[model samples]
Target: MTMELGLLKALLNKDFYEKNRGLRCPPEIFSKDVRKIKDCLDLAMEKYKADLTTEDLQAVFHATNKTMTTATKVSYDDLFRKMQSTKAIHGEIAEDALSSLFQQYVGEQVAQMGFSFVNGEEESLEPLRRLLDDYKNDFTPSIRVDWDDISIETLMAANKQESQWKFNIPSLRKKIEGVSGGHLIMVGARPNTGKTSFHASLIAGPDGFAHQGAKCIVLCNEESYERVGARYLSAATNMTMDEVHSNVSLAAERYDTVKQNVRIKDSTNKNLSWVEAVVKHEKPDIVILDMGDKFSSKTSDKTDVYLKDASIYARNIAKQYKCAVIWMSQLSAAAEGKVFLDQSMMEGSKTGKAAESDLMVLISKNPQVEGADEQDTQRHLNIAKNKLKGGWHGVLHCDLDGDRSLYTS
Candidate 1:
């Protein structure tokens, strides 16, 4: 008869109906909840009628309170108010009496709503599909752009007259092209193999990405941002490794030059949401995700769910921003051998990260040399795939010194 007990009954009745109407919960679910709530209420009423003494009432109070609290996972205020008016266990007793009770039946019914799907279950797939569909359509065309006046011929003629001539003439003549427009390029290698240096070289070296009108955002997943900057500065300014440490001013100059073309960012926290925000805001043509391990540990399980979700995120960012999204993926055991070209090597996430990528490049240590000159020709750059260009594997490019922005013959 207490206000709290009355509220408990109301809550249980409502909760039972709400849970049982679902696709998963059935009539048995509701019946179980009802029995639990009813049992607790009955015990509380009997205790109240038997004894009005503080200790006696406290026992009944505790029992009835326990029942109501466990009967349905409802809030305390409503139940307490009801008990105060009807059962009349007013003031401090009702307030402090029963606060910690929660029912297993209620929890069982509610926990299902929070469960996550494993792998490619229909529940998981549906949301992912919708997200992908939305990404494809999110970037609307700017209204003021002269769509009617745009033409390939006109664009080509304009390019012929503009500075783009520099970019195109070389492509047309030597077939050597430069990447622009927030393009993502991946440079992968095992630990301490100069992947960071390679990225720095591309952004700061004389003939690097900056010269090609590309601003590089280097996310140093493994190292501190300052360390990455030092390496890049040393490479770009042509300073001796020792001199870079002694001359802070030279490093500053190199930093300025780097900022002009490439904006360096670090991914030490394992969160990629920052990278996505940078892409949307800065719209850099060349965004390098550095190594795949930096894309947050949430995707670390290598499950089908993780792969599909992570790959879709990378691909959508690339397509939405009209930039090349390059993810640095690890090769599987097979990739270490001749059969490594298959998608298994991307560590953590599935092969979809590699397969969905616009381009996939594998950087591996060259096993050929063993003598004095071996250090000079240490690493081999394999263009394992260019999915945008039909997944073609090109000739191997070697980086001997590993100081150059690019590897060449």
Candidate 2:
């Protein structure tokens, strides 16, 4: 019957509520008679986040408004009937109507201000200027927020994606669960400490990320693309280069299973901006930056500032593109001939790289024997920083099969 109840009905429509629920349609616009009802509707919509029926509002109001008097109850029941008989308007027409009402309210405030100015209750035009300035951005509602689900139901279900994209390495999986989208995992090691092979094993080896159905792209600025491609070849077939040459047909057959998932590019002389462009074009599920530190230019004399800025860009790319980024880095000479490594051992800058990463796995090699000619295959994966799954920090022992370019327990 009343325009207030009709406006309330339009607010209940799913399309209108989703667009104009927040500060755009505050309960202050409603008259005192149905203002409480509008407040009830606001609370219900936020919790339920669904198109609510007339009965739903009545239930929510009564269930929450338990202390009301009998006369007030009868008046509210009459108001509900008026809302029930009203039809909701939709689309652009509804939005325009709502905008008109909000502007009318703003006009009423200015009208009051004019009265005050005329009656000598106000001095300068400063109050009117301040009022217009404050309302400038309220018309558009420019902020689009994606509210996180805080329900107890989301506590475990929030991690469902990570579990779906499970890690293939059994030992590492036992510590921190797996990585999903928005993960920046920085892998660091000395030059000959299987730096390239570690990723080759996790990405190209049997039962790796590629086999797990991830679209993988490797951008190598350190090694030639051909060299990186060869490692991937050895990893996919679990064979040495010599063995692959001898059994080309069998290796090709084995590589074919995950060949479509893998892509290698020579990204030499490229910066983070170029990397972002490739990511935007290809839209891969997993990205690897072999030698990720070289992506930044030394704009400042401080190595820490530039390196930290580069890592920030890398982190943003991972989050915006909804992909997991594996940043390959080299450890400094302080880490050489050492059995243990930490975040401080990362090359170039001290804490810049580790600070931005969600997980930092610093790989260290075992000390060499006095007369041994063979390179060390034993590695200790020190998880210096972990913000994923269990948040565990410790070492996991694994062996790097250099010939096959695979790491195994």
Candidate 3:
């Protein structure tokens, strides 16, 4: 017969327990109290003399439970069988446990590095990269080099069902066939040129992607949740902020419709690790990082290196999660007062353009022009780089309505 207490106590060995604190154990083994399980294991370790009888284990449990107002009621025999069965299937559980532990380790390390950088410490990411590389090399990724599973008939069927995913904006969508899987779309603009409004319109406007059943999560680091929400409401309802604030009944109705499809997070933490955690948990179809430069990274002191790493990380998130990421970036000061923008105007690094994005769009508007009418304040969406459908370069003109936060073609 298997020694149930001995095996249970061995499984809770100090090193194993420390590494896997949340390891799943049957409730009948410890009466659903983790503390009680630990106490029992401690007693077993102290009093072991080759083997423990049922009476001896019962004595330990009774002694430990005496101090508590309520005793821990566990069926010792039932627990023994459950634990034996668990041991039999330990291989599968152990594999999953190890994977979870590795992911947690990576998250904790990255989060610490981000905090250290944000605190103005000089840090090198070489060690972190090596560690991740080692972990990645352990498993060989399965690639479909041979078409043993696919047939010509199946390929034809799939082609018939294929469709491009697009934003609700007609002109922009027409210029570029909508965003697709693993796509990193970058939008850059000079200050106060309705970049935020443009992103908001994608989620809130009547024709927005959210209406097409796209679940979106917005990470707003530069603005408050209330402010973003206000803008979204105004754009979604085609009403001015003042109108929404004044009409309670209409505002509530519109908000109810908006909240169903989108989640807005206050990303003041500004750390990529936090972003990774949110993306992993929420698994949103669309992730909007409000501004690029504000995002915190492990090598934040080096602007070029940080931008490169951050862009790579963003692209990885899009691909790993099979979601489209819209990264809003700031333009260089040289882009100001210009009617057109190019790839050179991107603020931080060209690697962001070259390595990260599938599409790069620059929004240009002459905000400082004297006495320009609201209708004349035209914003141009310039397709600076298009990787999806090659050889497509052009600009789409949009009329900005600042009051309602709407952009119309």
Candidate 4:
């Protein structure tokens, strides 16, 4: 039989200690107001003449209402007696219990002070994962992985199967091929620049190698479902350019290869929250945010706040899901010629987006001489910064065909 009086004393003592100290007593019981748990165990051992096992300490540590939810068969005194039997293991157990208890009691206060988690410790977890669990459960936040996390082995694997393929392999321009995970690709051009056509070619033909065997989600903020559908139809049908717009329904059958696979949406979601939800649900291999300006928050007018939120929103979703996001951003007037720092072509809030982006590509119409013919208006894709390669730069080609948004090298 257990002494209910001893258990009562322990409970009463706990109350008294917390009252005076303005804090709950940790399991270690070493706080200024309370004696260490080891001392309590010693006193209980002398009083009960019973030896406790290591398992007994573990059981007691978990059993205490102070730390755990469930009650145990052993009285509070039995916990003391058992802990005294194995000082070393009990001490270690007490330490863990104490740390956990301390955290539970003080975590809220600590968070108010703006303390973050220690990396490589138990704190690493995703933010959304924490909200759903109970303290009967716990969660941690995971850090975002940068380009450095890509091991040489993974790079080698991404390259090994390619180099030797046949059938023209339907290669895209070097610019598109160079994009990888965790990048923010801004492909912009004057009206009719083949942005849509290029993207369709990627999704339907071999040029879309970046998306091959990869699950992709395209968010078409500017176009409706029917308009975008027709483009996709053209890419799959091998139909002449004129025939595609005329008979789009004919190409619907070929989508069987990608019908169930390729996820496309042609709706206007200005805030981009809808995109976030889709990313969470589908876990697509690549996500394309058609345009950047439409996603800005209403409360913000400054580019910093706007892009900052956009970056936070996009990066968080991308990192959490471990997928690539191809975000299209518009450039400003001066930005049309050269890639400027912080403010070049991005209409507003570029600093935040540029800072958070793993990579930035600048697209502009190739400079034309005064008398050049209309056909001479070529486009240029400049590698503004390839953060993964430590800020390297390169160039590619872009061309916008009339009415059809077919982007080509």
Q: Each model's TM-score?
A: 0.51, 0.67, 0.61, 0.60
Per-candidate clashes, comma-separated:
20, 0, 0, 16
lDDT of 4 at 388: 52
- Better candidate number, 3 or 4, judged by TM-score: 3
Q: For residues 328-355, could you state the per-residue lDDT of candidate 3 as single tens digits?
A: 9889898988877888788877665556
Error of 4 at 185 (Å): 2.7
The number of clashing residue pairs in model 1 is: 20
Name the runs in model 1 displaced over 4 angstroms: 1-176, 182-186, 246-255, 296-301, 333-344, 368-376, 388-392, 402-409
**lDDT per residue, candidate 2, 205-257, as tens digits?**
87898999999999999989998899999999999999999999999999997
lDDT of each: 0.50, 0.86, 0.70, 0.52
Name the lDDT value of residue 98 in candidate 4. Answer: 39
Model 3 residue 202 lDDT score: 78
**Who is ahead in lDDT, 2 or 4?**
2
RMSD of each: 17.4, 10.2, 15.2, 12.2
Top-TM-score structure, candidate number: 2
